[model samples]
Target chain A: MKIHEYQSKRVFAKYGVPIPNGKIAIAPKEAYDIAKDLGGKVIVKSQVLVGGRGKAGGVKLAKTPEEAEELAAKILGMKIKGLTVRKVLIDEASNIKSEIYLGITNDREKRMPVMMVSAEGGVEIEEVARVSPEKILKVHINPLLGLQGYQIRDIAASIELPRKNWKEFGVIAKGLWDAYNGSDATLAEINPLIITEEETMLAVDGKMLIDDSALFRHHDLAEMRDLDTEAESETIAREHDLAYIQLDGEIGCMVNGAGLAMTTMDIVTLFGGTAANFLDIGGGANAKKVGAAFRIILSDSNVKAVLINIFGGITRCDEVAKGILEAIEEVKPKVPMVVRLVGTNAEEGRALLADADMITAETLAEAARKVVAVAKEA
Target chain B: MSILINKDTRLLVQGITGNEGLFHSQQMAAYGTNIVAGVTPGKGGEWVMDGKVPVFDSVKIAAEATGANTSVIFVPARFAADAIFEAADAGIELIVCITEGVPVKDMMRVRAYIDQLDTRLLGPNCPGILTPGVAKVGIIPGDIAIPGNVGAVSRSGTLTYEVLYALKQKGMGASTCVGIGGDPVNGTNFIDVLAMFEDDPATDKIVMLGEIGGTDEEKAAEFIATKMTKPVAAFIAGQTAPPGKRMGHAGAIIQSGSGKASDKIKALEKAGVRVAKHPEELPDLFG
Candidate 1:
């Protein structure tokens, strides 16, 4: 749900927010062409999902088109937080008079959406909070009433903006809030909203996290999801309709619920084992779902053993046991499995698995230890 | 006494016609929950689960006809936020959305709307709350929980069961166990549930289960340090998880400088909440 700076700026421009003229290029030659077209100084920034690119040398200012090409060459394919720079945004550099931070997010304490502004921009908000908490100004919006003109003015004043620029700041703040609400964004931020030496306001950088649940309302935004940035196992899990996260351990876990998955992983580690992944088969672990789960875990070559933990209430333990037996037949995993079935129909489920010569534990702790031991042996 | 639901709490199941909805509804009904009605857009006026509960097209009509004040949603992720809002508008006091994959943006709006209303939402992607030996409003196994004085709150649903099992082995029981869900922007936070646990006289010691994500755990640590007086023991998961990667839960990601397991553990330790280095040490912390 993270969009690149160039993409975010496109959305911002739609809301009438002024953004620096920029063009994205996938190749160094294309970056040089764009830089030559813009003329004068241009800033070449790596197109990655993470921040701190500037400090990491992924961002560079070029005085000439050849330099821009060189900077783009250095930035292209550069890894920032595991995400490779596939493209670069080349834009005409702005002369900054002042920089400010503006963002909107849910303030849990006040139980309302809050707009945060700080005079010190272009830095992580956490750093600002840790250093000078008082520098950050907050304005809570009443959900029923929405953001109002006065609220924007209050934020503008809190940032200590000069009277001449107050009207322009208010207008920009209102537009940003509108775009945030319209896009169904959980977080819409403009770090370093700069005032140029020419007395023009422009959004130099933008970041947005769209709410995934609201994709139904905004089909246009849903298309922006970049699957390449996600883990391979995660994308496959989603396709299979299983909740999975690949980890760097040996014991592969298949638990019935989210909480159980975490505890299963915890207990596995406690017993001197490392978990390979966190896989929640959800409440009803049917044969198909269990089969999918097996395929996911077996796909991980690091998996030394598998643990099937189910506390079935609505999900009949007997049904889960059947699914495990069926999945074992389909996957034919070489690794040993430690199965624990509790709650509704647990005895019957255990009876089904008891005939399979599979390792079974009467309790979760016991099962976790057994799985860990089996993994260590493997 | 339980905190959220009991025998007297009437329940309405949303997305009743769906596969998950029907399955969990039957389970809740079997557990003695007063499941009076169900809501499905086109399946209204139909019968499901041996025709025990009437099905309605909308939450508003269902709430009016059945007088159901609580709702459990099994709607798909795409429609979850709207379902929550519909239930909230219908005057449902509590809504437990069992649906997962709800976009964080939708929940942000839904949560904000829920905040405006008097209703409380449990999860957009969680294994709902359970008041053991009374009524089960969520998908958790009712039999695993034994009603008593120990209160449990966790981000992980199955982990909550493990904690309950650990406590049960020690002959202790739960007053109320709530899974606040693992979504980044959820309706109820750890501090909100922790405050409720602190106020409940029936609850004595509190067992908190957290994961690496956001500043929620750190906020809970701050609350525990300054607010609550009851004994608290906590366990944080994803210790072995790689940095800058999301775990199973969408909200469970380590976004750059936020929500590290080691940081949260250190924060909790500083705040007087007994940090369990391992899951096996939970029982000892309570003792």
Candidate 2:
């Protein structure tokens, strides 16, 4: 789950990371008060979950409280990256001397948590990786031993930090790692960890992405989830305990397992078909789950056909067939459907489904072909 | 002849007292898995599932009493990392986490810890691994799997089943099929599984199921291009997925041109992996 920059900064500040004083505002008046409290010069930033807000005119500098209010007003109702700015963060402006970047994330290849630091900050790290790959420094932490003083020093030196600031940098790096580990964050990044004219380091921008699976242990962090920004279907699916993802194609896919769902779509496309959505009813393809899946698919107007593929193991094919029949009755599926039932009691499932208008295939390949044909006919 | 597991592998269930944990644990046991013990915090000394397997409070105790080397986790996402670490610390050789919604950061830390140890971690958000006609260590339906020569790997669970069903239609079955989970930073990648399948004598052909998101597919394609010797048939879902929208899989999002179905298909095709344009074409490619 991604938190807004302001929220991330709040968490960072709690960890003793220095950040410019900031207050979140939901209205222009609130922005004005925050700006006035910050002594007039402040940065107004839109509170969106995505990046490139600056390029999208979501971030603006204000010299006066009135300008801050004006900027806030302009941003409050504006849409950046499909999310309207409902709130703005007003932070005290600081004199910048130099900018640096620091972040912690899992390095898949190394199969370890890696801390990344660069002397150059205030820009996207991907650009840094592509343009000047040498500028970035990476340090992998030993999970058993945790981050040590030497590891931090090595990263600090690799980033070419001055000897005078090495100790402070080390301290900040260790703190960041601690926060990352403590919070169960997948990524904790401070883009543009600026050195102020006063020679003090401050995290000017903060971004954090927490792992959703870990939310069970961290109720405090889980409460920070912004449901409003998430997709309506995804939120509802979670409530139903169904694995659903809305896609853009015209064919709705309902399958029993993950790998099979991908292959079903792959076959659909191979047969000149476009899948509208990816729905996995999991191993529990009961009448209710199948009914819910049907409703979710019908919700998408783009859907022209529905593909139901089941490879029953613990999930009996006959039970899945009952679910499909019950769902068709409940949803009155307007679109065409291609059904494939394999494994346990498949023949019984096929016999039960045989009476319906739905097309049936013995194999997933045939099912995909049938669905593609149905979609083309539609 | 399977990649990671067979009928002889003894299984331990972590968080066995929970609804999903107990439900899938029973199903796995019924399917002939040697479920040695179950672990639930403070729920020790009670047998979950008709007193068949002893339930303990810790992985160490469960391992010591049962001599189980592999663990299947049904713990909630929050405690999943701790469960994985516990299993790893207990010297379990393979850990398959069936928990979903674990924060990517936690998995990274857990994965980092697992890397330091000799244990191989499957997922914090994945379905777990299934060796056909042998041991099923995840939440996937056991009936769909049949012991054969085709090796399947996928990021989506339901989708993985579709591929297996398609393969079964062509008189082919999986030696071992693994669902690596659909997360941005998963413990095992397609390349990792592909390498395993390549080395396994039982696996003849490999079917790779990928989705849009991240550069994992591109990396896998690069590896397949250079290292793989077996015939590989690949399929990428979410081709019709709207840009910027995340599919059912959280990691199945198309972002900034890096992880798109088209990009993945191109990369895989360039790597000499047989690309299936539609699910129906999969069987033809194998033939």
Candidate 3:
């Protein structure tokens, strides 16, 4: 659910946060046009959801339209952290007086949205927290009462901001909070909230991560999902309502719950096999969904075997077995498959899968051992 | 002798007219939970589950009519926060929310709002409490566990069942088991249930199942080291999970270099709790 810097800035601007005028460009010509409009001094930033864009040479400063075009062309096709840069943001470059970091995120211990500010900015906040430890200031916001004026002032003063900039800083902080809460974002951050030569505050960079469970309520944010940065199998799994994450291994795993799914993956590893992916069919998954999950698992070329484990509580194992049969009929998979069904209707589920060309086990330990051995043989 | 619910507990189901609510309501009643009433907002004046439990328009009316002191919610995620508010407002002391996908923001408010009252909320996305061979509340299958001396608390549903099944095979059964949900924000954490299990006389030993996510496990380990006198066995999943990947559960992710399975396991071992590398080894960790 991570959005590009340009999209985050657009959200920040809507909440009255001051941001440098920028345009997202997909091609060199568009970058040239945007650079010219910004008076030919701009920063070309690659728009990839993953971090470390600067370290990857995906960000460059351009002095003229020609330089902007060249940098955009170079960055547009470059890969940062395995994600190809499809778009570059051309923004007006500003003269900076100082930089600060401001962010709003959920504090798991506090169980509330916490606003954090640091005097050290334009760098990863984790590094700052790890090294200095005393530079960052945090305040928990009451979800019922929200970020108050006093809390903002306290953060501003603690960060050693000049009294002159406190008012503008407060506005930007409030704006950031609104954008974060309004969009159901788990994280909303502005790195280097810079003080310009004119003494005005501007957000130089932005990052936002929306909560997936809350996406049903925010359609606008949901459409902002970037597919290029995501694994194709993951996107397909999401469409099928299956929680799937691609991993590097030989065995593909499908289980009934999140906790059990992870345990299944762990057991596979403990038995000397690696799980290719973690897939959860979730609660109340039917035959179609189960079939879709099986298909998704086999779609990975690296998967040498498949393991299906179900502890049917709300999910009936017989339906899962039927779905496996349907998928085997369609996919005609070459890989070995192991099935373990337990809980409600488990005996019936085992009966349904008795004739299939797969190994059946009575417990997870046996299933993991068998799946690993079969995968190594395959 | 169990922690949360027992024979005297009068249970009410929220969203009782819905598919999940009706199904689990019947399951709970069949498992010997005292069925009192149900609340579905618009479906009042009707009796569900073979004309035994009455349906009311709201929790207030339902609580007043049935004298129900505990509730299990099956409402949808969209209205789940409101349902919690309604349940809390109606003076239900112990509320177990079986609904999943409740937004974190709503839970934050629910947490704050409930803290002001006398309520002890269990989960917004969890399988509810179970006192085996006595009363089954939510979605945990009724047949797997038997009533005995071991107290169990976990952050998963099927994984808990797996552990319970293993314990049963070892001739060990649970006094009470609680699934605290795997959401980033939970109403009851491991420490809360650990303290409860420590106080319950029917429990002799405790078993905990945790996955990588927040620092709840580390904190719970700290609590176990400092507070509890009972012997504890534990298991943590997602050891093979890669960094920055959400492993099924919303809370089961390793972020900011924290919430690693290795770290949680180390903390638990350091606290003198036997840690199992795999779920199958969990039953043997008790010694």
The prediction achieving the highest lDDT against the true structure is 3
lDDT of 2 at A152: 81
Candidate 1 lDDT tens digits, A207-287: 998866577788888888878677888888877777788888999998877656766887788788888888888766677
What ordering of candidates by lDDT runs from best to worst? Answer: 3, 1, 2
Candidate 3 lDDT at B276 equals 88
- lDDT string for model 2 (A1-378, tens) is 788898888888787788899999999999999999999999999999888999999999999999999999999989988888888999999999999999997664455678888888999998898889888888888655678998887777777777777776766787788878888786899999988888888899999988666677778888888876767887787778777777678889887765466556666776788887677777656767777777888888899988888877556788888877887887787889888887768899899988999888866667788898888888
What total of clashing residue pairs does each candidate reach? 11, 46, 0
Q: What share of the true interface contacts does each candidate keep?
A: 0.54, 0.59, 0.80
Q: Which stretches of candidate 1 lie over 4 Å from their true place?
A: A80-82, A108-111, A314-332, A344-358, B41-44, B103-120, B129-133, B146-153, B165-176, B184-246, B250-287
**Candidate 1 TM-score, C-alpha based:** 0.86
Error of 3 at B228 (Å): 1.6
TM of each candidate vs. truth: 0.86, 0.85, 0.98
The DockQ-derived docking category for candidate 3 is: high
Q: Judge candidate 1 at residue A87 and give its lDDT.
A: 88
Model 2 gets an lDDT of 0.82
Residue A76 alpha-carbon offset, candidate 2, angstroms: 1.9
Residues B1-287 of candidate 3 have per-residue lDDT tens digits of: 99999998999899999999999998998999997999998899999998999999999999998899999999999899999999999999999998888888889989989999998899978998999989988899988898999999999999999999988888889999999998889799999999999999999999999999889999999999999999999999999999998887888899989999999999999998999878878778775
**What DockQ does predicted model 3 obtain?**
0.83
| Best prediction by DockQ | 3
Q: Chain B TM-score for each model? A: 0.97, 0.97, 0.99
